[model samples]
Target: MNRRNLLLCATALAGSFAAAPLALAQDAPIRLVVPYAPGGPIDATARALAERVRESLGVVVIDNKPGAGGNIGADVVAKAAPDGLTIGISATATHAVNPWLYSRMPYDAAKDFVGITQMVRVPNVVVVNAARAEQLNIHSLADLIAYAKANPAKLNYGSGGNGSAGHLAGEMFKQRAGIYALHIPYRGASPAQLALLAGEVDFNIDNLAAAAPNIRAGKLKALAVTSLEPSPMLPGVPALSSLYKGFSVDTWWGLVAPHGTPKAVVAKLNKAFTDALKTPETKTRFAALLAEPVPTTPEQFDAFMASERAKYQQVVRASGAKVD
Candidate 1:
């Protein structure tokens, strides 16, 4: 062969060799880690995306790592090999609030992971026990505030955990409304909701999904949702922002991979998941959970995380919330 032809042949062969491994890698099953127990909003949303991702990516598995207020599961993804095969579902609590809520966090939210995309933003609802509401004559946000001012520490509020989004939302409500209520933290939303239902706690700011059935069944009384607008599921309920101007607190879920994951892989994951959000079935599911589907590019997700981190830092300082 001529010298020029020889050079071209060699270049083609090297390119083929380099491309072979990547082709194989693309076919591997991607692992998506959910940093909470099954049945929670994060897990449900992750599984929904995973199903669609499997159709787009060929194979995907959802792995639930539920402990340490979601930090344990998040750390596993943070430390995993950044080969693009391992990804995680993280919420505002894990990425934005935990750093400020805990004196020491296991991983740096910004540095330890590269954001893929935000999947959904779920609003929380302020729910009171029907019995408690009737007994205390707490019929609305104004009534609740009046009761709190009158009762002082007599009224208590429950949350999912010390550093969870619900806890922060409750604290924000306390600070914004200038009310005094005892804060009770539980392992997760189930126990906290149970406490409110059983009258162990007077009220709680809880995920709308967990509180929906109770509210519909008349077991729990929903006064106002924590979002800027009223939730479609509970249209009769008012928004907290209506009571306290500019008041809004929401729990959101996003996808992330360990830092240094291949750019192509991250792009692929983002495309697959974002596309999944556009599907009619996915939209309906999100609506049922009172979670709005929020699909964003990686850059947008990163910017969102930064803003959330700053916002939560201010909230933590203002509320004086900390994890021991």
Candidate 2:
């Protein structure tokens, strides 16, 4: 675990901060570790929920730790003492996909962390730089396929990192389209979006929330949403399944404490977060980000995780993605 773990003094936190008034920020704040860079979908969600959770839980802080496809930060939480003070805001990539993709994982996704509650689910969109899309005359998924088929390796895509949901989606796209494209992996989703903005890659399948501002600003053109149905956030963007049947890939964010965290503590944390999600301000903010709040109980979240992990296990195996 990182030396920063010692700074939180997590075990002593309840005694020091729990009794403090909620209005007055506590001396020892709960650290909400985010395994991705700032400005991405997960970061935005974490910061938003952190404010609301603080009101009920005393004080909460967001800690960004991006690397190894989110395992670095997740491992930090996994290894931390099972105090409620240390928890991580994780995504599908971190909790479900990484376990199957990496040969030697830093932590066990299912066993190392106790599920608190899922915060929200954000659909992903296939997008290209507006200028490039215009130049290439790619107006939709069909156009993208035609272009890629005509130009083989000329087409390229960017992803958050190897074994990330974005990476798997890109591979699925190529496999279904019968086209070849080079893969460019970045440290985080926001960095991948930056590369797309600079035209570093031809396209990217990015979370709609992270790409919404740019797409609305015309910096990027959303061609298709990676869901069974079209995204309500981007109603005009067609669903990828329209082009290739049964296509789906949506990313989500949620909270989890280290394994052995008391069930009572987990329930308390879940209540705080779910209460935050029900707030009007938080709801409006999450809508603006194009994420739907989905607060779930620990048992429900555990089952959801199992189903998602099983679904992505097949995806990773079929994609032949290896993070050895």
The candidate scoring highest on TM-score is 1
lDDT over C-alpha atoms for residue 27 of model 2? 38
TM-score of 1: 0.90
lDDT: worst 10-residue window of model 2: 18-27
Q: Each candidate's lDDT (Cα)?
A: 0.86, 0.85
Error of 2 at 97 (Å): 2.1
Q: On residues 88-204, what C-alpha lDDT tens digit does candidate 1 reach at each position? A: 987888898888988888999989999889999878899999988998888998999998998788888998777677778888998888888888999878999998989999999
What ranges in model 1 sit over 4 Å off? 1-25
| Pairs with steric clashes in candidate 2 | none
**Which parts of model 2 are misplaced by more than 4 Å?**
1-29, 37-40, 150-154, 186-191, 194-200
Q: Mind giving the per-residue lDDT tens digits that candidate 2 earns over 34-135?
A: 998898667888998888877577778889999887889999999987767788976798888989998999899989988999899888899999999999
Total clashes in model 2, counting residue pairs 3 or more apart in sequence or in different chains:
0
